[model samples]
Target chain A: MPALKKKITKPPTAARMVEDIIGCKWSLTVLSLVRSGVKRPGAMQRRVEGLTAKVLNERLRKLLRYEIIEREVFAEVPPRVEYRLTEFGNRFGAVIDQITALDEERS
Target chain B: MPALKKKITKPPTAARMVEDIIGCKWSLTVLSLVRSGVKRPGAMQRRVEGLTAKVLNERLRKLLRYEIIEREVFAEVPPRVEYRLTEFGNRFGAVIDQITALDEERS
Candidate 1:
């Protein structure tokens, strides 16, 4: 007889994804910077004080994993990488903007 | 002379509050249960598997701290406590409903 199994891990939902994305203060800050057209990693690192390259890379990877942001590589002698929100991310950003406004109102 | 102090904590914004509230799997589950009419603590605890009284109390306290939910006590032999969403929470709930629909679509 086959052994019975129970799945303990549930797939992350949209809400869960949002929670995960914004749970970190740095991730939230990074998302805002990316939304405001600060695209390159180096630029983002410079823009946010105390944000190290390693941590920024991890945050960027997470954003990419969740389809919140996408990267573009330009063909050049020195390659240029830039980040932008996907369509879904744009929609998510709209919700975030609402939250920002709500924050302004409440705080 | 008084020692110079550096403020280490950021006052939680509305977005931060939402992030904190939904960051925990159990907290998100409890919030949903409360939103769906699971008012009493005992009932909420029974409704969610693996939710203990201690954890439920903690989540409830966090919710009350954020002003997301308010509690009412009734006079009886056994005092009855009920939880309900505040006006701000209702607005927050509208955003939550949007996220629920989004989650249903994405997941």
Candidate 2:
């Protein structure tokens, strides 16, 4: 078996953590759409122009791995699977709002 | 000559702009160090662990292109060059602070 990667004892700097979360292509766009209530994967793909399903899935998986978002599965007729921001994710939303405000201030 | 990319500009969304600014490797770390008064390029590279001069220069160029940081040159014995955040850059700092705070809150 391949050797497991060493566990990181030192937590990353907050800026580094935030950068990792947002650095991937489509990550921020996916988060923004989720914050705006586009929770379903199909909806998110439709909302973010030019974002392919494959790319969206990748972004969503990353966000899930980071614990920034949570996935809920329902046993309904259509078997719904939806995503929502975790508490941490909501906190991130606040940061995004601040960034948006900064951009507006400059413009 | 290769066709120039068309520039029919409908400006990007605020979230997209913010992501573009922070998405690159070492971009946020460099920005954070600069905001914290590590103004000189050499100083910044020294301060942010694992940041090479080449990577730092690339990030600096991108920041300059975005008008997020301004470069100043002084004609001294060795010719000093330093970077300072623009008005917009300071605004970005506030956003970074918010992200930092959010991280702290969760931890």
RMSD list, candidates in order: 6.8, 7.2
List the candidate 2 regions with Cα displacement exceeding 4 Å: A1-13, A20-25, A100-107, B1-90
Chain A alone, model 1, TM-score? 0.79
Clashing pairs in 1: none
| Model 2 lDDT at residue A30 | 88
Best by DockQ: 1
lDDT of 1 by residue, B31-92 (tens): 88888888999999778889999999998898887788899999987999999988777777
Residue B55 displacement (Å), model 2: 19
Clashing pairs in 2: none
TM-score of chain A of 2: 0.74
